[model samples]
Target: MARPQYILQPVNPYFIAFSLAAAFLLNLLPWGKLPGIPDFVALVLLFWNIHQPRKVGMGIAFFLGLLMDVHNASLLGEHALAYTLLSYGAITIHRRVLWMSLGVQAFAVMPVLVGTQLVPFVTRLLMGASFPGWDYLVSGFVAAVLWPIASVVLLLPQRRPVDPDDTRPI
Candidate 1:
């Protein structure tokens, strides 16, 4: 039997576009005061962080975070700072987290999610906005909860290995 040839492939543009669209859609969803559906963009970003860290890193995170900031009409650097920091954290643990079980990865991401949200929360506080209440933290919990699902979804396509030999013309 011929040995399976493994190739280091470039990142798929489709996945990047799809993930970005999903993120934007989720951001636009009317989740007014809801506790379950937090920032889907953040959840998906975490998925990509582990799966394709090189392709999607702080630059993408910063851009997406800025979009969210503009959409939400919040302070300009609020989400930007949070996302930049989150991206750095994700890259730091990408290797170790990749080898862990899904549950473990999800649990590990929980704090990062919370921390991302807290940055904006604390920023608002410092800017003299009234306390936004604990409800704000709900988004972090929701993001964490969705991490496993997002990871599974993003990884599904990559699970099936491609046959390099099959590419030869008949």
Candidate 2:
């Protein structure tokens, strides 16, 4: 049997804003005290970057990273640099990534997320900061694991009735 086809629908800008805000709020939750929690903001941002590159890009990533730095009181530019690179990676292969199944997409994103984490890790190491332990790597894995859930949640708003101009079947 042929696989089902999913039509691409245009996304509302406000919906993107709401999702980003929600992700930031999730990041701000008290879960910081709990180890192994991933960065929801990064995950959401990466999702948008891949699916809606026109709307979210490096500038937004940098700005969000700055906001994160303020929220976490971490070294400035650490996340900015990391997010910038993450955004770049997403934009670079977004088409390829989007073409894959959700499970495979998660696998594709694992390296990019892990690469993002490396920026801060290396920065901290250079500044003589102690290693945050193996658990620090857990966030990337957690984010990778959450990829399919996030993809479905974020894509929900974009999957609407087919547009009349488009002849593609839903």
Candidate 3:
């Protein structure tokens, strides 16, 4: 399958940190609880977890989750638990994910994305919060839809230049 580009160099740790911070900032924007607004943090976390598990592991996921929890001011560990689980799922399948085409990769990771949302949803319900309806899952689907875009953007820094000769790649 054709990829956006192959990585020719090691991914920089700083870029990973920047991407996570940017995603968190995106989440901080006042969307006023829109049902379909995707969770930018979760999306980016999953991307990095899958693509660079060593650099962005569950610890970072938990830390970011804590920040999210504080910002949302919901139950203390909701986002942390969710993001950790998401990271675990991604890391487990990272190798397989890298081989698949972007479109298939999105579908492959859909469950992890949606399940990440599920953690907080279930927690809220267990604590007597009202059912948020099925729209809660919409963001996961949206994130999956954006999978290809995220992969391309995140991989840009690590991409190799294509060879001038058509026979050789990267």
Candidate 4:
């Protein structure tokens, strides 16, 4: 028997909204002074890029990044640029990264996540703002560390195979 085809379908708008809301919630979580915790937004973008690249692409990432800029009261477009670039990079590497084991993906994604954060950090510095300190990169580190966990959680909904014999037609 041939293996089942995994067709790429558009995710429900509700799901996209819920995922963004959850990411914002995670970002707002009061984790004071935690080091190396991955940024929730980056982790979510990575998960979506690997699993549903067709549905959540750079446009969505850029929009979400813009929202973060507004919510966090930061310079406009700082996160927008970072997210756009990161999402592009993730999508470009999605095929290879998706085939790897979770640990490998996590390790591979670290630099992308860090670079996303670092771009904004450096941009702010060039604008004459004092450094936000080394701790500013903590979110990127956290995002990398949380990669495995995020992947597991995001994949949970897809674990159960849909019954082919059901009334629904393919």
Q: Best-fitting candidate, measured by lDDT?
A: 3
Off by over 4 Å in 1: 1-11, 161-170
Whole-model lDDT for model 3 versus the true structure? Answer: 0.91
Measured over all alpha carbons after superposition, the RMSD of each candidate to the real structure, in angstroms, is: 4.6, 2.6, 2.5, 4.1
Backbone clashes for every candidate come to: 0, 0, 0, 7
lDDT of 3 by residue, 6-65 (tens): 446788889988999999999999999788888999999999998888888999999999
Better model by TM-score: candidate 1 vs candidate 2? 2
**lDDT tens per residue, model 1, 26-116:** 7898778765567777777777777688888999999988998999999998998898888888888889897777788878999888888
Weakest lDDT window of 10 consecutive positions for candidate 4: 2-11
Model 3 RMSD in Å is: 2.5
Q: Model 3: residues >4 Å from true position, as ranges?
A: 1-7, 160-169
- TM-score, model 4 to reference: 0.82
lDDT per residue (tens digit) for residues 6-108 in model 4? 5434456577668767987887777776666566887788778877788889999998899889977899999899998899989888898877777889888
In candidate 3, position 104 carries an lDDT of 98
Candidate 4 wrongly placed segments (more than 4 Å): 1-13, 30-37, 163-170
TM-score of 3: 0.91
Give candidate 1's error at residue 148 in angstroms.
1.4
